[model samples]
Target: MIDNNFKNEKAPRNLGLYIHIPFCRTKCLYCDFCSFVSRDEQQREAYVGALLREIEARGTKDYSVDTVYFGGGTPSLLSAEQIGRILGEIKESFNVSPDAEITLECNPMTVSDGDKYFKELRALGVNRLSLGVQSAVDGELKLIGRRHSFEDAKATFLAARGAGFENISVDLMLGIPSQTLDSLRASANQVIKLAADHISIYSLQLEEGTPLYRMRERYSLADDDTAADMYELVVKMMKDAGYRHYEISNFARGGRESKHNCKYWRLDEYLGLGLAAHSDFGGKRLENTRDMERYLGGEWLEAASDISNSEREFEFLMLGFRTADGISKSEFLARFGVGFDEKYGEKMEKFKKMGYFCEKGDALALTESGFEVSNAILTEILDFDY
Candidate 1:
């Protein structure tokens, strides 16, 4: 169905594929993602089958897939065989590049037999692993409803390495319940000791309707000021440890950034293939149905809207600012036929003078202080009617 809409494409483009697995063992207290806690193997198999069918129906040989990501409610929850089947279908349906960066998000607790499990995944062409090690503090982990302990995460990381995985990422969280500066430092130090290729540190956001939000009064969550202090400390620590703060929430060794994620920031075309997954492709924005029954019944599309030029411009600036590299002035002009300064220079000069913005060579990026209050700055600067 999607193929018919984009059949007149003129040239081949590189694509990133995102496959969502919306099943988890237990939902975290702060999670708002589209995931269900289900142990029904039949349901999992049925979901996989639907994904395979969608891949066949929408996939085109017109694009070369350079990155494939398995994200979700713990993608590693699926057995290696199931993951392999999905990857096999994708390869058969699309022109997947030989050196495509394949990444899978894993929960440490789900890796029952890490050695065998990770080895099988490696053999299936999955080259990167993103372990959900939310905190190295066992108490904090418990308070956050994480099933895996710090030890479990460490063991899983070691096992992934034993399975020949070189590109591994560990996730850490700030502003968890009962998180103090010392506890935050300990968590950061412990994850750093693992020497993972990438580390993603996120500030926990309390979403409405989540368990954490309802119990907000019960926990000693870090205040705004404390959270900002924690961020500053971690940035310095990561830089000292030779990791680049490549994005607002991501740190990585040189040349180890997540290729699939960069596609989103760069506004490159990517196709999402699962329930509640979203795709920005064929000059349109598409979202798959969130209802499980609708998804399993082969009614995939929930919404399809054309992305207007102005919307694209806003997104290019918004997403680009999330990265340390920011936006390229030349590329902006080349793509939109308008000079970046001609459009935004007047409004941004105040912030630049105040040390919130920086221009290095061709890149216009936000300073560290700018990232601190990026929301306020973006609100004021991205106010143009065009």
Candidate 2:
């Protein structure tokens, strides 16, 4: 059952919608997400049907959706008709803003044609495209088990441009097996020249069950210091290339920041649909079960955990610090009934003196170096329990 608490709330309709597609052509060696390699047409169709039904069952026309993100194993794996129908359902079921930022995450190999699939997706209301171009080197891509080569990624990017996608984001990986500082810099430079509207720089994690983790000694991965240097170099490169480092791992040109992802950093309410998705609504956190059978059978959400004011305060500070704009002191005071400075002023003074923090007007944000050690900084703050 849909939670009544979210429905009863008097807040303005600023909901975001996220649709997860859990099908991929091939699972990457390092991927641990809820995705699988499947060519079962029936299963794909069935999954879409279940997703549409869930949208109808949970969505309200009264809620004004500002953004809709179709993210997944590979959203572009579906036919153009399938994408259009899913988008059509979302529009019919909700008060989606006419100018809503709709994004689709795709793999380079999936949209290489660009003339057909990507163009159709654009016409279907997908204004932004996030292409998974993990590296610029073919060898690194092979090490990471990506299906597409660097040439394929370049071709896909050019195709997206030809297909009329002005807002394009490319993903880049920092640490990979057999990756060196020179190779990392070369990739970063090449991507910068691509002039993608946005870039998401991520580090490779050695998840326990991943193939890379299992055969860890086969490749020479960059050490922690080298990885940190790689990140710093990338940050400098992006900035010099006229992109703003708006978040810890995200850089955008002009005002091309990701609307859907910004909702996550701001703790705004968003509804998640599909297998293994998560939702934050009714003042609680809810995660849908990962079981495909359960999701398709109409058992959608798992359970809800109500958020406390204390938890909210902590998140506000932590998430806000991740952004370039930082936290708003006035907003904090308004939300929590206490001045932010009064609560954590003394604690932050030490860091401020160390040049880790910058205070301009009413906003307090971390410096670039501070972003490097954000976890440690956040942990220390949480430990103090202000």
TM-score of each: 0.95, 0.95
Q: For residues 20-42, could you state the per-residue lDDT of candidate 2 as single tens digits?
A: 99999999999999898978989
In angstroms, give how far residue 167 of model 2 lies from its true place. Answer: 0.5
Root-mean-square deviation (CA) per prediction = 3.5, 3.2
lDDT of 1: 0.91
**What's the residue-level lDDT of 88 in candidate 1?**
94
TM-score of 1: 0.95
At residue 51, candidate 1 shows an lDDT of 94
- Residue-pair clashes per candidate: 0, 0
